[model samples]
Target: MPDFSFDRLRRHPDVEAENLFAVDASDRLILDEAAADLAAAGPGEVVVLEDHYGALTLGAAALHGARGIRTHQDGLSGEQALARNAAESGLAEAYRSLPLGEELLAGARVVLLQLPRSLSALDELADAVRRFASPHVRVFAGGRIKHMTIAMNEVLGRHFGELQVSPARQKSRVLIASAPLPVTDAPAWPRVARHDDLAPGLSLTVCAHGAAFAGTTIDIGTRFLLEFLDRMKPDAGSAIDLGCGTGVLAAALARRRPGLRLIATDQSAAAVASARATMEANGVTDRVRVVRDDALGSRPDASAELIVLNPPFHIGSSVHAGIALKLFEDAARVLRPGGELWTVWNTHLGYRPALTRIVGPTHQVARNAKFTVTVSTR
Candidate 1:
């Protein structure tokens, strides 16, 4: 058996800091417990979900000799890191990335799951497993004990008949669930909700995939940013909703100023799908374009006159600013000279300095007890 080590893992193109890590004890625990079954499985029988890097997938392939593993990661950065780590470890052929749907779970007998913190995300995963995975599939869902909750067990219970929880080891635990139950109800994903008071004379229909932040409801930060929509230059030709979660900013912009061409982009596949659904529900599909990308990586530089952002302050449970700063740089690159970048962030983050340094001159547009909205010129 080959020795699997986390030292080989990397978070390339993502903000890497000393406090952050690519792999943790939970990955090792899951791989160790499932090593026997995985080693006995044939090609394509194993599936991995939400792998932070390539720890579980590559460990199963390299150390346990599992073959033809399929995997799904919601974040583009996670997918990119997995590929890079696999290549560096010479395990590139061990697994393949697929969307979180039937294709990824079809016929999978053993699923290695890194438990998501969101119950809605867990519901979506459980639904797919019950509907698509093999009848006897065993799901090994594990996470840090601090992040695990009783609600997660309930979510899995809805899909699997037997649930066995492992005693905590190294501050991590695994839930072993088997015996798929029949679920005839339609999936609860892409949830739709109406917000009547988001703005005056405006009712925004928000569509959210299971993993999307602030699902089907507007966040206070965004609601604050909405206050300044009318303040943007009237003649700005085009705009972008950088890091658009559910296309709230983009849809609102389109609705407020009818003829504006708005593009919404996010790295999460779920976010892109949700944003598109939101646009259609709001009847702005023709004006708002949704794309899954890593911080405007797919968009041309200096092509837009205005951009809006509500950047995420965390990365995989760690309160890190790498993701937020990356978005700021992206916004700076995408905005034309003298273009405006509107942003909302937590006041404690003190992102104003970064905005000034990265985007150009920055000024406070609005602030409340907890949030601050700023406008930066490119």
Candidate 2:
């Protein structure tokens, strides 16, 4: 489990009630000396948060008495962690949080950002901040040692203002803006109403804030599954798309069939945000529910009619088959006698045998050059 311990940090004299919320954050102040800088911040200030790189928000909460801050991310885990960090620590109700595509980010004098993993997300944020910030607004951004480079500085400098680095402190540094003015240019990427045509009336519009396997034009494995999913004709009942990045499969399947009550689940806040955005864009916001979850956690109900998954091969940099196997086992526990399960994976991972153990019978609908969509009948 990810550490939720903030027992030590809370004891510090300078930490504010809002700052206490950093407890659940993925930010690592344990090793870094940014704590000194955090101890220095004061009241009613606004800041912008970078994606998964969370020092700024936590720092702002800790030292600055940060108020009215704006934080956005395309990663579902990132946003969830931020919220968890805040809520579990008693700061969530106090801080202002918004997803990437939401409006109402205008009017701020200070912007704190972390360079995003997606260049598109990065560009979009920079452009958005530049448009909204006051002329003399101060833009500060940071990253760990590995990501700080001339290219990063160039990206920051071009979009916001003249950039300068703080003295290296514990393998991390803050990027301070020299001068910044409101950018007059319109954003290069705007949220569109329609993208690819999955069907005549089913135009797919993206949540532009998409990152990783969720956004890069759909995963090959998922596409393969989507193409052949109808062969099984999933029964009517509550269904879940476990690890539903952007909720693509869950949303698509639910839209195709009305009886399937679906919930899309993922641990990433960025993914959750995108899934929500996609849900809104596709006008299925009322039809499907989205959850910030881990491997389906423990299902409250004993039976789910259909469980569809395009299980991930890795999380962050860790690759282990244990979680996927656990999800399959959980599926068996929650599935009714006539329920069904569907999954697609890369060709070589050998998922069918284990899946068969849980669902009773299994077979492939179609095998593309890179993936195979499998159906397991209970």
Candidate 3:
């Protein structure tokens, strides 16, 4: 992957509001010059739409500090990435990410967007933009010049009056846009209670904004985890829901064991926020603490008795298993002796040996047509 972060930081340490929203595979870093420009913007607030890989969200935090919004495609790590960016940038005090796809815009002052990979998503975003944009909204769109396709500008033009491209520098360009017009809102996509028939007492209703794997419904992997969940005999005494994307697993855990204090942690701000909303839908938010911690970065020593996961194998399109391996270590570090670690994974990922190596002992818990679930005891 290209190091967009290093490139931006190297070339433009001097620009203001260098805050950015990114695609799933961005390589952005905080540039000192850009940081200084942000200080010049003073204390003004900015909005970041579609947080892919978390580059723009980090920039916004670096620039505005404590005033940021990150919308994530539905998944767990995207929630976790916001935390990682906040930690590496030392901007935790100034950064907060909203789960992407939720109803947002509580009077946003400015909008910063990284053109999404999908032009269809761009159409959806244009409608989202108009909700917060009046004639007064200042919008800046950033990406590599190659990413700024004509369809991309058409979406912006459809929502805002016009788009003027900034001179290409270091192979990247910015689209400066303003003036809101009457743009037809896209029909809301159906999102709540994916795949299952309505169960009067066991149904889950989510406020879904499409994006992420299974953004529109329950994902197959998640469905496997839910099926494996022994609702009647849920382990208690503190559980950690790893990669709590949209909080489905955490919510199910909460619903199954009302007394459990589950910690919802993921790499994506969207996942964290989704987890929070999922718990809230069940009236169990008070029982869970929604944390924006990377895998368990903020977890105290020996803090959890049960750790649940549907481990992710990649960071964007880059296949790096290091994150999951590191998270296994982190989970073991935070679990009490002999604490249980439960997981459901795609059968081909060769996850068992890794589980055994990390947690000391592993046992096959269950299996379905396409997946195998395991419980590792530390």
Q: Which candidate gets the maximum lDDT versus the true structure?
A: 1
- Candidate 1 vs candidate 3: the TM-score winner is 1
- lDDT tens readout by residue for model 1, 195-238: 98976767799999888888898999999998888897678867
TM-score for each predicted model, relative to the true structure: 0.97, 0.68, 0.66
- lDDT tens readout by residue for model 3, 1-378: 122242333211111122332332222322221343344343335566655545666655543452544343333445455555555556555545554333455455466666665565566666666765444666666666666687778878877886677666666766767777775555443245533442224556553433333453566777777765553226556788887767777777777667777888875554555566667666888888888666787888777789888877665334556667877888888878868888888788778899899876887877778888888888
Overall local distance difference test of candidate 2: 0.61
Error of 3 at 300 (Å): 1.3
Candidate 1 regions off by >4 Å?
1-4
Q: lDDT of candidate 3 vs native? A: 0.61
TM-score of 1: 0.97
Checking candidate 1 for backbone clashes, the offending pairs are none
Model 3 alpha-carbon miss at residue 312, Å = 2.3
